[model samples]
Every structure is written in C-alpha cells, then in structure tokens.
Target chain A: MNDKKTTHFGFQEVPVEEKAERVAEVFHSVAAKYDVMNDLMSGGIHRLWKRFTIEASGVRAGHKVLDIAGGTGDLSYQFAKLVGSNGQVVLADINASMLGVGRDRLTDRGIAGNINFAQCDAQFLPFPDNTFDCITIAFGLRNVTDKDMALRSMLRVLKPGGRLLVLEFSKPQSEILSKIYDTYSFKVLPFMGKLVTNDAESYRYLAESIRMHPDQQTLKEMMDTAGFVRTEFHNMTGGIVALHKGIKP
Target chain B: MALFMTSTLTIAALASAEKMLNAALRYDPATRIGLAQLEGKILAVQITAPALQFFIMPMDDELRLMGNWDGDVDTRITGSLLALAQLSQTEIHNLKDSGVTVMGDLSLLADLQRLVKNLDIDWEEMLSQFTGDIVGHQTAQMIRAKFGWAKDRAQSAQRLTSEFLTEELKALPSKPELEDFYRQVDDLRLAVDRAAARVETIINRKNIKEKSNP
Candidate 1:
C-alpha cells in the first residue's frame, strides 16, 4: 500500500491513474470478439465456471443487486431473474465497451424492465451505502487496478446481512493440472487469440492477470479484512475458479 | 437453515424454480444463485439483446456445435455448459426437456462486442467495413506499449482494410509518384484501423440504446 501509487497493467508496473484508460482500450479493441475467444480458448469451460458462480449467488425476489465489473452481465442477468420484477439489478463497469456488451445481452432476452446499466469504477461505486442486497464481481476483479479498494467499496455498499460473491480464476488445486493449464494458457491461448480475436496481446494479458490475482485463501482474508462475516471459499474444478462468499456483518 | 430465508420448499416456488432451472440448463446459469434450486432447481443466466444471435441460439444439433467442445467421446457426456437443458444429467433434466429457449441477459454490450470482435473475425470484418480506418497502427501500438503491452503482445493484430486508403489515394497530387502513393496506401491502412474502431463504438452505443428500449 504505497501512497506514491504504483499498479500493474497486466504484467507491467506503472502509475495507477493511467491503468483504467489502458484497460479500457484493451476491452474496446476486443469487445466484439470477446465471447468467441472465450469459447475457442477455454473450450467452453468458462461457461461452467460462471455457472458455478451464479449457482452460489443466493439472490431472490425484491432484492436489489449490484453487479460490479459486470462484463457482458453474465452474473447480473442471473441476479435479475432471481430478484424478479420487484427487484432491480444494476450492471456497472468501468469500461463502457464491456458494459455495452452486457446491456445488449440482457435486453435481448425480454428482460429490460428489471435491469439497469451504469458506467462506474469499482473503487467508487455510484450508489449510496447499504443499498444493495447483494453485489457480485464475476471475473471482473482481476482487471481492476486496486483490488483492495474495490473490495472495500463493495463492503461499504452492502446492506446489513447482504452477501458479496467474488467469482474469479484462482490457483489450481493440483500441480499437474497447474502445469497443464499453464502450458495451455501461456501457449495455446495466445495463438487462439491471434486466430480468433486477432488480439494475442489481450489474451496474453488475461492469462497473465489470472496468474497475478490473489488465491482463494488470500482473497478470503481480504474479505474478512473488509469487515465481512462468515467469509468462506468454494473451490470449483480443482480450484481453477473459486467462489468467495461473505456476509456484511 | 442459515437464518437467510432458508425455508422448506413449497409447490409454487418449486414450480418457479423448475422453470428457472430449465432456463439455466439451456443457457448460462446465474452465479451464487441459491434461489434457483431450493428444490435442486437452477436459474439460467439471462442475456438480453436486440440481436440475440450471440445468446439465443436454437438448441438443436447446431446448438451443440457452437461450442465445438471436443470432450471425451467414449465417456457418457452430460452438462458440457454448452449442452441444451434437455440433455443434462442433473435431476433437473425433466425441467430441461420442456424446451425454454430464452438465453441469459448480458450487461455491457461493449465487452461482448469486444469479445465478439476478438473471437469472431466475421463480426470484426463487418465492423471494419462499417467504420473507416484512420488511427495509425504505429501510433496506437506506441500508446499500448507505453502502458506495457509486451513487445510480443503488442505485435499481434488483425489485418483490416481502410476505407480511407482508396479515398485518400484519389485525393493524391495530380503528378504523384509511385512512392507517394505507396506512402498514401500506408496512410490508408491506418485510416481503416480508425474506421474499424468507429464501427465498434457505434455498435456499443447502439446496443446500449437497445438495452433501454421497451
């Protein structure tokens, strides 16, 4: 925690202020090809990972939900339904391009009345404190410049007894699987990116960022530090993807 | 059980849960969604869109092919994420066989469009044709490199034609030399890049407009 302000854009060290714009550029460049690349590189496993995340979210009717870094609204869409007509799901993200992708996806399903889209940075969510019943950041936290700051903001915005679910890539459970995933991610992923999205660099950054994110235990501790109670992690698929859930006590 | 509204299953809620679970088995499921299956049901991830091409694919044989997942052939396969709800091995299989076709709702279209452009070259080509290129690659590359895209990462790119190239070529000097036109062609390529960027911007904004539609 240096006040001088340093951050990482993928693997490179830099001043924190410029990171958001750079992140935006990568997303904007790849917005259209994002989903196709996900299928090509992950062999559609990302879908299962996301499914696990949704299954863990516990949202229900009349519950106000906040989907931070809700890229393409994978989780927000789920929250919208569980919350039903009386509840509202706000899909927010720093990158307009990513938010645009999510917004369009939700609208096409005949679900416009229950959802809203807002462009916001996670470090400083636009909503007032204690407003949401639940908040989720699915695969969105790794792209943030300040993970701790974003987590704190998330904690601050939750109503008492509200839950926060962090669904993201985590360290693999097995060394053998890690090695295989490493080789596959570092090698085949970039090549697939080149062929599909024509943006090998973005794909490379994604792989790198996954390696850099906090592991399940560390993330759980961070949640605890954010004043959450009953913080626990659910390891999915050998821990490649983990769901960290905590209640706002 | 957890004092978090964990109540015994009712028939009506169970039915609603079944409907939602049926949807999830067909599409993407909501993350951390406990309400979906109080009775072992699951809610599908919702995707809303004007296009629906990306989300709402018909769950036919063609549907399974969209993933192109080459999972093991010998093993009995069920629930590959891309599998239609009817085929899942979960107890919710009965719900899946009911044929609900709405895909999950998407949040930010720009993100999906970005993914689509990266994964679907056809989509990218369509965008590039709609938008003319103008921003110089060298300049754009320089910007990204400054922000730390690896030398290897910065180099990977899609080759797209510029609408400005031909237009600019026509505007060349009356007695322009071959070298001048060659440089102009280079400039045209840059223009095409800009055009592609614009098309993406338009698509993202258009999608947002669609999201707000009734």
Candidate 2:
C-alpha cells in the first residue's frame, strides 16, 4: 500500500495526490472571474497591499526576479518595468488556468520581452538550483498541501545569500480589528462571493484556507527551520497580511 | 536526433496544454469554443480598474465574510454573499434557522455602497449574469479583475533567502555612483525587523525579536 496517508479537502480528508488537481480545478473554475472576485472581496485594498510588497521587495533595475504563482502577472508586469531590458522576471504558476490569464494580461499591458511564464509546482520547481536572485510567493503558499516541504524546496533553490519574501493572510492583532474583520470576512466576504462569482463554495474554501494557513510568527519560524537566517515579518494592515522576509545564510 | 527528440517533446507538451484547456472549460458547454481557445494563451488582464477596496478599508479585516461576533471571520461569507443579498426575508429567516445570520448594521452596508459608487462600478451590468453564491455577477467580475492581479502576484513571490547578495539577484551597476542594492538587503531586513520589534515592545506584546542566527 502507498505509505502516504490521506489529508483533508475542506473538512473531509482526501488522498494527497488529488489535492494539486483539485486546487488546479478551483483556480480554473474562477480563473476568468478571479480578478473581479478579488476586488469585491477585499474591497480594493489588495492593490495597495501588493504595492507595499513590491516596494518592500527592493527589486531594482537589472535585477532578475521571479514571481511564483503569479496568477495574472500584476507583480511581474511591474517587476519587468523596474528590471528594464537588462533584467528578467518570470511569471510562474502551477495552475495553467492562472498562468494563461497572467501571460495574456502581461502581454496586453505592453510588457516587453523581459517577462516570461513558467507552469511549475512550488515544491518541485523546474529550474537550476541557485538560479534566481530573489524569490517571492504572495498569498499562494497557503494553497499548497505541504507548506513545510514547499519552504524547504525554496531554501534549496536559493543561493546562499538570496532572500525570500512570503506574503500571505495572517491573524489580526487587536481585538477590535479582529472583531470587525470577523464580521466582514465571515459575513461580508462570502456574501460578496455569492453575489459575484456565483460559486460560494470556492470563496468559503478560500476563507477556510486562509484561517488554516500559518500565522506570521509561525511562518517566520518555518522560514528559520527551512534554513532561512534572520527571519522577520512586517505585519501590514494590522497583521491582516504579513510579509515574512528571510535570507539563506 | 537528440535535438529532434527534444523539439518533438516540446510539441507534444504544447499539444497536451491545448488539450487541458479544452477539458477545463468543457463544463460550460454553452461557452463559445473561441472563448475556450482564447483561454489557452491566458494573457494578463487589462482591466482599467479604479482603487482597490482593501486600501479603502481600514484593515484587511474588511475581507472577512462569515464568522461570529468574536471577530474571527466565519467561512460562509466566501461563496454566499450575493446569494444572501438576493434572499427574501423568508429565505433569510430559513437560512437563519440553519445558523447563518448575514445581516449587519446599516453603516457597513452604506460603506459598501459608497465604495461601489466611488469606483464607478457598473453593478447592474456586471451582476446580471452573476448566479450562485459567489456574489452578484458584477461583484464577481470586479473581484476577479481587482484581486486577480494582486492575489496571483502575491502568492508566487519567492526570494533568494541565501544568495540575494550574489549576482543572480544583483543588478549590474557598471558606472560609478550607482548603488549595489543586494548588499544592502541584509541591512534593510534588519532595519525592518528592528522596527517591527520596536512596535511589539512598545505595545507590550511578547518578545518577538529577530531570530538570531543559531
């Protein structure tokens, strides 16, 4: 028998092998409708959140950068412009549906040759070890089945001094803010989902997934355990999302 | 022969990709094959959108949908927002019987209304086709457009935790006077950490200092 036990999909547990495909299906179902849903759900603050992440990234001209799980390539487009002709940015995603959307969006935006697309998984990246300068996975890590293994894979691929930036939804800090957030996400967010995508289950999955994801501190520790030295996190928007940055020593 | 084999493999790969897109969108049989074919090249979205709500909201908490009064979001808000809006009083009451109460103070609703208006969103046009529990059609379209760029970008951001200081991450500053940015990443990381630590300390939160290189 296959030694690997099954894991949960939502509340009910399922076989591990099926997770990636299921996740892919989830993205596919919402791929064309993904961006719109994001706005209604987040109330449009997600843009600034990303701008903050980009600024914090400190990627400069001629610096090669990679945006993994770059759904529609928003960051990649910006990075390409920042990197200029001498630099390169790869808009990579494991979901072909997302990657297709990203590639088209980037091309439409008049992004030049510096940007490219790669359909690859997070845990098993398809590139030479130590090939990239900076690697970032925003909001995407939580969707992966084995996050620890994913972090370790990232460490292996990073050069000795390469930095990793992990940006994702995290636990809020203040009680008042938490309460307001609770009312919004649980009450308003899925309602927005139902009103918009016409698929409530997917948005519910998204919320549960965020809640299930490791918090900023836990992710920082995970970074350290995965071999990143000097782990730190910036709790943006009062810990709603955190940018965990660390380096390979 | 090897080159031929490699090129052939690439061709096969492309063909399979074509096959996958065909399979993925097949569920919506009414969707035009042309639309399905175009879904193949998956381009970056070219949305001429206004400011995002996450920015407008006081915090990310605004994104929470379902949950209790305790502040942690309940999960039902994910796919059920618009459907709830469409629900009649009796339907809402029936839903309440099932333990889901979506109603809230009018101020929050007003906030959402103002935000939609400020963005000049075409709600009526957008929401007409929106079916199911995800949201109104217009709401879903906007959500996908707005967050698609960000969520996708944020999820896939990987950094060179070890070699950020190396050439792979380093931009060539050939002429004198340009800064060597990667060398400064470590210092920047420290600066950020110290700032975060200071905030925690100032607030009397737990000792969440930088993890020293053990």
Candidate 3:
C-alpha cells in the first residue's frame, strides 16, 4: 500500500484508509431512514431508476446474480422473483446497518430460499472468479474509495459474456437543469434531511460526493479500462441519474 | 401413499376438465376469439386447499391440459376450486374483488381473463353435430322458449316491484315533487345571494361617506 495514498470522503480529502470508516459513519447514521429519504428526495423516481436497471439487466431464471452495495435490497427482491427457485441472488453491502435492514426487508416480503447476504467491501468481493452471470451496484459506487479497483474486481468476478449494471447519480445533461438540480440538491435535500432524519451534514456529504463522482463518459471509459467491453450508459430523468452497462469479454 | 393418490387424482381431474373445455371450445367460435390471444402460452392453474397443479396450453386454435410442470411457469392463476368455477362464467372485471387472485405478466393475465369471460358455448350448434337437424332444431327452440320465458318473467317481476314502490307504496318521490323541491332550493339560494348583495351595498355606501368626511 502507498504510504501517502489519499481519497475523497465527499468533498473532503482523507487518507485512503480513513475514507471507508467515514463512509461507514455516513451510512450508519442514515441507515434507518435511507429508504424513506430516497423516496422523499427523488420523489419516488428512484424506483423507476432501479426498475430500468432490472429491465436492462436481462436476468433470467436459474441465473446467478450479485447485487453489490445493495442497500435495502430493492433490486435483489425483484431479481429474486425473476431468477425464481433455481437461481441465487447475493445482496452484498459493506455497512452492517444497511445489510441488516436489507435482510429484514427481504425476509418480511417472504423473498427467501434464493437470496444470500454478505457484508463485504466492493473492492474485495468474497466469491469465486467468473461466478456471477450478472452484477449490479445501484447508487452505491460513488461512495467507494477506489472506484477503479471496485470496477476491476467486478470484472474479475463476472463470467464471460456476463453483464455489469451500475445505476448512479450523474451530471445532468443540460446546464439549466443542472443548475436547478444543484440548487435542489444543496438546498432542499439538506433541509429535508434535517427535517426527516435530523442529519443535514450527512446529506450535504451525499450531494458533494455525487458531484465529486465521475461523469457518464468518464465512467464508461473507466469501465473500459477495467476490461469491460462495449460499455454504454442510459441517462434517466434529464441525466440526474444514469444506468451504465458493460459486458465482460 | 396419500400424496401419490392425491397427485393421481389431480391429474385425472385436470384431464377430464381439459377434455370438456376443449370440446366446448371446438363448437363455440366466440370463445375461440379470446383463447386465440393466449396461443403458445402455458397458464398454470394452482387450486388451493388441496393444492393441485394443472396447466392450460393454448396451441393452434385449441386449449389443452398439459399436466403438472415443476419447471419455470410463465403465468400462474391461484385460487380455490370454487373461485375457478366463478371465473368460468363471470367476467374478470366482475370478479376483481371476489376472492380470486391472479399473478403473471399483465397482458397474458388480461388475455386469459378475457378468454374465460367470452367462453359463451352454443349448445344448439354443438348438439346439431351429433343429432339430426330436425331434433336439434326442435330441442334448441324448446330451450330458447324456456330461457325467453324466464327472462320475460324476471323483467315483469322487476317492473311490478318498481311500479309497486312508485305508485302504490310511494317509497320514492314523483317527478313533480322532485322538481318542486329543486325549485325551492334554487329560490332559497337566490334569496341569500340578494340579501348578501344588499348588505355589501350598504357597507360600501357607509365606507364612501366615512372616507369623504375624513
């Protein structure tokens, strides 16, 4: 490991070792309210974002699926039904609180006999190579310390011809819309966080982290660099969110 | 031993039902219109309580019972046998809240529901195929007369009840009475509006005098 390695904890520069702990703190602080906050903040369009991801996933029965950083298991629950009894879906998240909430939610919905839970960082997936037919990380990649390493790890685990779908907040396509989105994110989002979860700082960090993340083209190039072929992205809701898909050759 | 017996019985019952329905669909062109939409699809019917599995395969102008599949199901319809009975004769729109549950692709489920509702069997035409034309025609005429009489009786009974309620018992108001009631309410509203206008005019005049004096 490089002794002087540094990464971003939202807008703040921190040691690579410290970024994961800081991100854990943010997620742990907002874990209970994560789902509700997503609804309130995105006006329930986050469901559509995740739905589009599932549709584009082309997942089928008897296929093995991995949902990394799958907080609350929104994608996993649907994938469980799509994959049915013969298939397996693993919901992996680094934060224990998020993983607990996800496990409980899936159990309560009676989505079992097919789903498994794992608590592990995205950069080091605990599975055999070429094991999964599909892997998805929804709205969770931006928070990782080394996104390049995470992409490489995902590529390493995906089977030949298997696909990876990354659903994330991206730079809005138009300037006027971007300004409006920025205003809403910086002003209304924090205010909502304070009102709902009483954690404005965490939400502020969320906004900053989204801004600090790479743009759509940059991310596709990064995936390409990580050995994912034919990488493409679909921008949704005026590019406030994007679903990037790539296939392993 | 019990499980094997039950499975055997289910398969037998499904085969019989499929034979009966397919025979009916063979003679009834109206029912085929909706079932045609479900061609090349397997609709799994799961009857609860005893928990029986049956499959309906719509293929080339016919619906056949392809028995119990343990593999991936395309569309599944689950309910009690009683619910299935109700589904055959009743429109799905009518059975929306009637204790029957359907889960599958929306379009496929809709086609199946439509097929169930539109399955109007013409027994006369079916009987003509087996029996001679004269006997079939006479039998059909007799049946139609009976049905027509029943329908006329029902309509007459409904009309008698309505006439009794309106003319004899006076349970509902006459048209004249209803019209008078509406006119009185409209007059009362107009009177209130006039009174409010007079009050506003007086207030405005007083305000104008007060402003001029000041």
Candidate 4:
C-alpha cells in the first residue's frame, strides 16, 4: 500500500531524495560553530567519548583508516597521530563547508604528511574495495539519508578483519534518566544553541534527530544485517550516546 | 526547594571546574610535557569516602580522560578524599605511610611524586596572552619574589616544628637514639651470622666423617 520512499528528517517525513539536501543545509549553517557548540552542549564530554572510541578502535601504527562524515576532524586528528607516519587517515565528509573547516583546523594543528581529506558521501564512499583497515563514523551516521547503504559502503572499503565503529546519539536506557535528558535536550539545548550559534532551529533539529535515531539494539541488528560480524554497542552517559562496533569477515 | 537549588548549583559549579581544569592541564606547557611519561599508560585514581574514580591518559602534552575506564590500569592509586587533598597540598609525605594504598607499578607513584614536586606554572606565559610581555614579566617577577619569601618562611617554620617535636618535646626518636637503634640491630645481625657459621662448620665435619666411613 505504501510504495513511496520516505525518510524522517527530525520527526518530519520527506522524500529520501530530498533528505540529503536538507541535512546539508543544516550542517552548512552550523559548520563554523560546530566544535564550540559541541563543547558547550556536552560540556566537553565529547572529548571523552572520542577518546573511548579511539581506545576501542584498536588502531595502531601503519594502518589505513577512513573516517566517514568526519566533521571538524577531531577523531581524524587523533587518528593521524595514532596511525603515525607509515599510516594514512582520510577524513571524508559530505558537506564541503564542514570538510573545509576540518581541513583548515587540522592543517593549523600541523596534522599533515599522513592525513588526507575527502568530500564524499557515506552512502557511496569513493575508495577502492578493501581499502581501509578501520572505518569510523562519529556522530555523523545519524545524518545520513540511508544508513544501510552507508554501512555497506563502509563494509565494502574495509579489509577482512577490519573494524567499523559507529558512534552516535541513542535512546536512553532509563525512564527517569530519559525524562531528565528530554528536558535538557529540548528546553536547555536549543536555548544554548541560540545563544552560541544564533540558530535555535538547528539545535532543535539536533535534539529531534537524536531521538529519531535507532536505539542500541536496533542499530546492532542493522549492523549485523549489513554483513558485519560480531556487532556490539557501548552505551555511554546513560545511553545518551552509544558507540557500536562491527567487524568485517 | 532550597535543597534542590543547592544541588543544581553544586553540579553546575563542579561541571565548570572540570572543564576549566581540563583546559588548564591541556594548555600548561610544563604539566603537559611532564605528563608525557604517562604515555600509553592508564592511571586510575580511586578516591574513597566520596567514592570517585578518574581514569587518566597522558599523551603528548595532553591529559586525556578515558571515560569510565573499567579495564585494567597500569597503576591504581586509592586513598581517602582527605588524604588525596593532603597529598595535593604536600601536607602528607610518603603516601604509603599516610594510609594511602597503592596497587600496581611503584614507578608510577614515584613519577607522580616527582611531577608534583617539579610542578612549576609559568604565570607570565599565561599573562602574556592578555597584558603583553613586559608587564606580564614584571608582575610575574614581583609575584615570584613574594612566593619565594613565603616559601622560605614556611620551610623554616616546618624545620622549627620538626626540631621541637623530635628534640624539645621528645615526640619522636632523636637522631642519636635512631643511630643507636641501627647500631644494635647491626651487632645482633653479626652475632647471628657467627652462630650460623659455627653450626655450618659442625655439619661439614660430620659429613666428612660419614663420607670416610662409607
């Protein structure tokens, strides 16, 4: 009965084709203030989140890594050091503005000779098959129009025994904690966003999008369906954010 | 309502303090570089009483907090919150003697102690960002002089207090008493060694007779 392909964009249903454009606009508007807004909203716990991701990543020297939708290059910067001179890290993002900001920031931090940049969509990574030893999407997977396609794309580029780590906002595990989180995300978050970036709607979208994202179990199942073996998820900050990891066969 | 308000205010202040400390530790050149010895090492500090655990990773001039590191740490330092506070103030010397329990590598404890002793904050470098070089340098020099005078006074006071306790009040063993105790222990050890040698000589003579008879 329902033949039309529609996807939810922050609680609103829209054609799958148009979702990417809408997401692009939101990122383009907030790209400049993304890092600052993250520190403000999360109170710098995002750094700890990324640090945990790195620890679980098992990334070592001389490994090729791909960071999909790597906005502002925080993960990429750490990965560059981890991979060392013998290794390579490609920071890929769909939004040019976000990618440009990431490139400039990383360059300013002297992260060169090992790190590369790419403005590519997650649904269709432009790397060769079996290209990377590890692939990471930190807080970037929720914005993708087709998460399944992106997962498969990541899988395609990953070598056998390679790992895929998906770090994103997820449903809270407790009812009481969920209530507090809802209050903070809806009431306090948008106001803070307005104060910093002067765009309440963008922050509102962030909150809504996080709610709409797949919960931990569902995401683990989805990763399994995408032909990734041994999928697991780690709930952090009372399930406010989850880091899901899967391995390629 | 007042209780709830107080708790909320406390949480906000703690959060602010954590953020500020994170930035300060990251930006301070000496602390950052000094922490490099902790590279690839996960150090966990467990504060009893309040029951808090902080996992620390020291990278190249950066102190990274690995969130809720429940894994095995290279070193774990546990103490009462008061003891840890005393340690930060250098009020407690010798953590093991101060009732602080240390598990895992002892080198980590030594490294941390050395780091605490050598912690020198460059206030002028921090001030130069706001007030430029010359004024910052002058202000820093003045502050350093005052700090030096205070440090001298404190050291002298500590020496006097120690002397009063050990010599005047006889609260602790005096130097001669301690030396005499060490001398008695050494003599006892030598006497034990001589007795052991006599026993060994008897055993060797009996063994020789048994071998000759066989």
For the second chain, the TM-scores of the candidates in order are: 0.18, 0.18, 0.49, 0.45
Best by lDDT: 3
| Ranked by TM-score, top first | 4, 3, 1, 2
lDDT of 1 by residue, B30-130 (tens): 32122222311222322121111111111111111111111112112223222221122112223344333322322222222222221212212222221
Query: Model 4, range A117-190, lDDT digits (tens) per residue?
Result: 99999999999999999999999899999999999999999999999999999998899999999999999999
Compute the interface RMSD for candidate 1: 16.2
Worst 10 residues of 3 chain A by lDDT: A47-56
Give lDDT: candidate 1, residue B101: 39
lDDT of each residue in B99-207, candidate 4, tens digit only: 5787888676566555544445565664343335786576567656756786899999999998999989999998899999999999999999999999999999999
| Predicted candidate 3 versus true structure: per-residue lDDT over A115-196, tens digit per residue | 9999999999989999999999999999998999999999999999999999999999999999999999999999999998
Between candidates 1 and 4, which one is better according to lDDT? 4
In candidate 3, residue B194 scores what lDDT? 100
The sequence of per-residue lDDT tens digits that candidate 2 reaches over residues A183-206 is 887777777777877777777777
True contacts kept of each: 0.00, 0.00, 0.00, 0.03
Interface RMSD of 3: 19.3
RMSD of 1: 27.7
Give the number of the best model, judged by TM-score: 4
lDDT of 2 by residue, B158-203 (tens): 3343234344555543323245565577789999999999987876
The segments of candidate 3 whose C-alpha lies over 4 angstroms from its true place after superposition are: A1-3, B1-214
lDDT of 3 by residue, B157-197 (tens): 99898778888999987668889999999999999999999
TM-score of chain A of 4: 0.98
Which ranges of candidate 1 are over 4 A from the true structure? A1-4, B1-214
